[model samples]
Target: MPELPEAETMARDLNQRVAGFTISQVLLAFEKIVASDLKNFEKTLVGHQITKVARLGKWIKFELDSGGALLAHLKMTGQFIMGDWPGHLSGQWPAHTRAAFLLTDGNSQQTLFYRDIRKFGRLRAFPQDELLSFLSQLGLGPDPLELKPEEFHQLVSIKKARLKQVLLDQSLVAGLGNIYVDESLFAAGLSPYRLATTLTADEASLLLSHIKRVLNESIAHRGSTVENYRGLEGPGSFQDQHLVYGKHGQNCPKCGQALAKARVGGRGTTYCPICQK
Candidate 1:
């Protein structure tokens, strides 16, 4: 699944490329991908102009001039590609393309394709009032980058689950998934199995700092591309900088001991046992 950095990269890239463009038409290859009412989805977006693009946790928000919003969640293998329209009658859609938005900027036209191999991703177009209500109902926690050290400490300390499980919970700290949680824990020299309430003030502070640093660095590198994650331009290069996410049985970069893997909260977790005490 695309985490914070990956989703952030997509939002930033999309904002840069398609913010002011108008949606000339919308074609849904797979109607099931639409989370909103099928009839209202196409009616709300066909003539609207995109005003801004933003990311809320793992969801991308497209603010429209019509006062509504088109929101998307790239669940696992979803990606957006900007390219020439292959013509509706050509039947030349790219592999796994679930939706396409034909965009125009007065002179030229481009199609923004949403591809999802697993079909778990979803898109929704909501009215202004309903959009606000729907977003509020998600109950996502604060973004780690925006949280103060003291605030982070309090949030983590209140959770009774294991540290790794707490970190993975979107309601506790938004935008962290399995990949970044493992990397953040490894970077902070903390064990995944440690209880969340057992974290000292110092450990919590260090963990919060590392989480922000790691996420910013990953965004700078365009996010880790372990599987089918790609920005509007291309795949990210951060996988080369991974410290311990998928390096099970590999020697730790800090210590020479082999990295170990275990199931923490039913998620595969990798850490250096010698270094991450």
Candidate 2:
């Protein structure tokens, strides 16, 4: 699943590539991808020009000139690709693409494509106020990269859940997934199963700083490509730099002890048992 950094990167890329461009046509292969009735969805976007693209948590917001927004949640296996020609990249879809947006110049007919696979992704229309309302309802905590120590301490102190669960909870802190959660925990020398509320102010502060450091460093490497994640091509290079994630039974980068894997919140979690304790 695409987290904050991935979504934010996509938004920044889309903002640069799609903003100020008008929609010439939207081709919907799946209906649920659009929130409104299909007809209304098509009508609402047909003539609208993209004003900006921004990300809130894992969701991508495409602000239109009319003050409405197009929201997309790229759950998994979703790729939004822009090209100088329509359907320029075809083979990536077949079984994966749920929808396509052929963004055009609205004058010369040049087009770009937004494609998604697995049908898990979606594109929806939301008025500005409605978008805000939806975001508020999501209980999404602040972006991990932007979280301050005070805010991080306060959130952690209130939770009695396991540290891993608390970190994975979107409502507590947005953007962290299984990969970064393990990475952050390892970086902070904290065990995944430790009680969240047991963390002291100093420990929480360290965790907070490490989370930002890990995320920023990962983003600098264009995010980890554990699987199908890609900036534009195949897997990213950051996965090579992972300290413990997916390294179960491998040597810990810090302590040389065998890394361990345990199920946390039903997700396979990797950590340096020696260092993270």
- Model 1 agreement with the true structure over 199-228: per-residue lDDT tens digits: 999999999999999999999999999977
Per-model TM against the reference = 0.96, 0.90
- Indicate the TM-score of model 1: 0.96
Candidate 2, 1-277: lDDT as tens digits: 8776677677777788888888877766667777645666777677888999888878888888877778888787776775554343552444445666667665655454445656677677766666678667777888877878888989987998899999999888887888888888999999999999889888999999988887778767766776676654334566887888898999888888899889988889998767886
Clashing pairs in 2: 96-117, 97-116
* Shift in Å, residue 27, candidate 1: 0.7
Candidate that would win on lDDT: 1
